[model samples]
Target: MRKEAQELYRAEKDKIVLRPFTAKYPKIAPEESYRIQLALIEMKKADGAKVVGKKIGLTSKAMQKMLNVDQPDYGHILDNMVLPDAAVFLAGELIQPKIEPEIAFILDRELTGPGVTPTQVLAATRFVLPALEIIDSRIEGWKIKLCDTIADNASSARVVLGNSPKRVEEFDLKLIGMVLEKNGDIVQTGAGGAVLGHPAVAVAWLANAVGQFGVSLGAGEIVMPGALCAATDVSAGDLLQASFDGLGTVSVRFA
Candidate 1:
């Protein structure tokens, strides 16, 4: 990445709570994009931020096709991105915000290596919960190239997890049904298969990808597989709820 582009990227990310840049910077090559991402991570670390987990994006075939990418990409979610139940925020607080239903995994053991398997991910997971991922795009109108999105932490904003949790063995997560509701009305529905054929497979892919960067999925961290369905736009006063068949539900109302 050009030093100029790296500096611009960091400046844009640092404004997460203010006026986030909505326009894409100068086009950056893939290697430069990765460099920009590394710079952002280092900047966050300099600010004493701790990476709590990872989020895999574009895992579904539909998303891949929509983004015109052949493979999945992920981003690091810091400890600050996590919000507890009943958390409130303004709809205008984020730029180009969207919400998606997801299944989140809380791991009981560290997972590393390129050889990690889906079965191992399943075995390592301690619990699963219904989750809503608040996705915010730093790029204008959610317009961005794959490299731009990856460099912006995969558009991650905030994550809300449900109160109820289920053990990995208690549910066929690969087949769990999800219904996304806005204003108490169903807007979209999907199953776990929409996520890379199986949610565990997405987790395995994330573990392998992190390994390539000399990192590993640590114990007690939350890992969110890709969304179970397409993202739904949110507006002020919108009451959003994501109901999972057995894992229970999570909801948030925009102010």
Candidate 2:
């Protein structure tokens, strides 16, 4: 597992895609995958990376069903993974980069529990921001199973956060609407409810899920509940923007 972790770590650093571990380790369990992810994270930390937050993936029922998983997966978000809204970057720098719009929570209070509720998640949240998650896979051609993705840090790459921040009580997140546009054309539209019925519910699940590992969703850390829609492919010279009903817009440019 440690050797596999090293391979994944090197893949990210070298921007190289690798064959899915499942091809060789077909019987790999989800638990083993998470352990590999943790080991990979430790490798990043040892090299001076700082964990700034956490990201939850596969929150939608459709995604879970497609992945043959019953629950969402998580990955640590490092400080370097964050980018400002309207940022531009080279497309060739990433391996199979894609984008997903999400609601990000900046917690005001620490949340730790084996049974955290959505209400508690809201209480602990300081504000929610419009976000764009740039997801990439270290696995070749993005062929991955549940265990494959779990071990690849949930395929997290970069995050772009919007300027607007609103408290949970300000609006009903479950009904919040979002429209994704690429090159000035609408590509996808979705509602927050697509994410585990409500985004906060997913956050609550994350808090409890990680609690079993003795990890707490810390105060002031950004927590991305999940994507509102399917991720869209990214390419050079492309401009993408996501507009939420009340959260304003966040965008990125691929150079």
Candidate 3:
């Protein structure tokens, strides 16, 4: 079942949007879904994919409620999945894609725990930066339940990280603001608090949750805490930019 699911997803990567797993099978346990996620990622690793970092998703209360899931999910970040600052992402390479402005935590030290605190997350962080997490789901029409999303690697696609990296103490992250623009026009705006009250809160939540599965957030790993607002849709030839109040801006052109 695992290999079949993995091959199904691999074969249909950007070819067809898929039905939710729940729609096609009996209710799946979150643990089972996560196991499938690990298997798929491992398959990618066997194909020479390198682990770069991790991403936390569904951290917002609104997102949780929308998916009817009370807990957050995580996805692995591969070295090849990271685009340079302002890099263009080929629209032809994705299914249905969306973008969200977020704060990324670059860790200075390994963080592992079932009791990791936001303070610990901040203390271990080397710095933070403005980022845009490009999300794409293999799920058809984005009709996904929590298990479906979890099994699909939390719908992660790629990340566009900004250039300027600032120390956590250099600015107040919770009060930081952001303006998201598409094609040079502002389309959405938000503050850091929109991410589980504060962005680091999500990071802390991730460390503790994933740690239960024996995943340790390593030093030098980049952690995407979650989006600050609702995500914006993207299309070919659209240029998207996010400007943070303190952190500089990062842009991506869909081509």
Candidate 2 is scored at a TM of 0.97
Candidate 1, residues 195-222, lDDT tens digits: the string is 9999999999999987887889999999
After the best TM-score superposition of candidate 1, give how far the Cα of residue 211 lies from its true spot, in angstroms: 0.9
lDDT, candidate 2, 161-201, per-residue tens: 99999988999999999999999999989999999999999
Q: In model 2, which runs have C-alpha deviations exceeding 4 angstroms?
A: 65-70
lDDT of model 1, residue 247: 87
Candidate 3 ranges with C-alpha deviation above 4 Å? 11-14, 65-69
Candidate 3, residues 1-255, lDDT tens digits: the string is 486357536744646777688788667878888888888888888889998899988887656765577778888899988987989789888888899889999999999979999999999999999999998888888888888888888888899988899999998899999999999899988899988899988999889888887889999999999888887889999999999997999999999
Root mean square deviation (Cα) for candidate 1: 3.1
Worst 10-residue lDDT window, candidate 1: 15-24
Candidates in order have lDDT scores of: 0.81, 0.92, 0.87
- What are the models' TM-scores? 0.89, 0.97, 0.95
lDDT of 1: 0.81
Worst 10 residues of 2 by lDDT: 61-70
